[model samples]
Target: MSNPTELTHAPHRDDVGARMGMWLFLFTELLLFGGLFLVYAVYRHEYYSQFRVAALELNLSIGALNTVILLTSSLTVALSIGALQKGQKHLSVMLLLITDILALAFMVNKYFEWSTKIHHGIYPGSEHLLNLPDGQILFYGLYYIMTGLHALYIIIGLVFLTIVLGFVITGSVNKDSYVKLENAGLYWHLVDLIWIFLFPLFYLIQ
Candidate 1:
């Protein structure tokens, strides 16, 4: 294996140092999420019928719409990176701005989705859900646990992206060094990936 110190000494051309560290971080993050997914799979199997029934309450169309929004945001982020590579500062910033807008839109959708469910007495351990079957309650319990954590990570990813955009706007970053953008994008893509799985698992009831 390569020496750890050797890795750090890589040339910093185009913010390569930052991106290298970010890629490594993303690998670890994926492993962590993998464990969570494993746990979810076990629980899902134990309560398959309940999960299926509970999933019907969620609007698949909304989940699908969010998926499209996240994918489009990812694409915009990609375009931003490409613009930076081409030394087109204005174009890169424009794309970043679009990303910010998309992030806000995503949060808006999430809020409405969650709130609508909450209002409909779909939340776990709520008085409103007092009449729900135990299995259905368990299904919603897992749903809240999984999706809540995912949402937290999405917020964190957005914060990181916003910080990177701030750097870009303040001239601390530029076309020659957009590794931070790439790093932030990695995190954003992870958020997107999680939601992709979440959509099918939580919204596609047989």
Candidate 2:
């Protein structure tokens, strides 16, 4: 029979394997977004003028504010990981909570931005949108599709961070076993990286 001591010991964790799996998952996400980028490039090329006009319709202030928010959140997440690595559990948890708040702020800003667009009749398939030229119509379609997907990613990342925060609180993730927090940090960075690409694509098309 296995020793009682062995039974009580924590199970061996494959940190390397876990990290590799996360990277692979991140690569697949990149592939998915890459395809959308290609489509955007193709359509934008054909409808450059319309794309610019459509881009102008987007709220620059909100886009810029969200950019700052996500960037700040990324910094906080990185700091949280560093804090955990250095055995500062309380600081790590605090920083992570700040990151989560920033994420929620980003979502709130997005809600207002989308609300403004919809209120202005710029959403997909609305009479005003449909009445626009084909390029403009296509522009709004892609806008909704890409930005909406990005928002979904933000929500997913929030859930991951929240769960990891719980782990940190319970001492499940500490200096000796912080791969979970590190992985969560990587995922949050990916979320920020995607927005870095998306901000320019949808907001700064001029």
Candidate 3:
């Protein structure tokens, strides 16, 4: 019969496998977005002037605000993971809640930006966009597709973090077993990284 102390100290598989699997999934996501980036680069090169003109139609202030929001959210999620690792469950939950609020703020800003554009008759199939030059059309097309996809990822990350928050509250994720929160943090960071790229390409370019 095993001693009670020995039973408590029994070895189990580390979380390395779970982390590796998450990394692999993230690699696939990178490839998918990389292809889109390549396409954007090709078209931007072909229509440099038109692309610049099209980009100017976007709101720099709103884009920059959203960038800041996502970056801050990323930091919060990282802190949440750290807090969980340190056995600070209440702090971790509060951090996650802050992250969620930031994510919602981002979506709200995005909604207003898009709505303003649409109000001005600037959208995928609108006659205004259809009348623009081919390069301009391509620019707006890529802008919509890339930003929309990133927004979807943000929503997914928020949902995942919410679920992880529940797990933390229920004690499924704690100082000893918090890989779930770490994985959620990884996903949230990925979303922020994508926007980091998108921000400069779409908003900062002249």
Overall lDDT per candidate, in order of appearance: 0.82, 0.92, 0.92
- The model with the greatest TM-score is 3
Which residue ranges in model 2 land beyond 4 Å of their true spot? 1-10
Give the TM-score (vs. native) of candidate 2. 0.94
**Residue by residue across 1-206, what tens digits does model 3's lDDT show?**
54453567845645778888898999999999999999999999999999999999999999999999998999999999889888899999999999999999999999999999999999999999999999999999999999999999999998999999999989988888888888899999999999999999999878
TM-score of each: 0.87, 0.94, 0.95
Alpha-carbon error at 173 in model 1, in Å? 1.5
Ranking of all candidate structures by their lDDT, best first: 3, 2, 1
Candidate 2 overall Cα lDDT vs. reference?
A: 0.92
Choose 2 or 3, whichever is better by TM-score. Answer: 3
Error of 1 at 113 (Å): 0.9
Q: Model 1, 70-138: lDDT tens per residue?
A: 999999998988988898888888998898888888888889999999998778778967687766777
Residue-level error in angstroms, candidate 3, position 149: 0.5
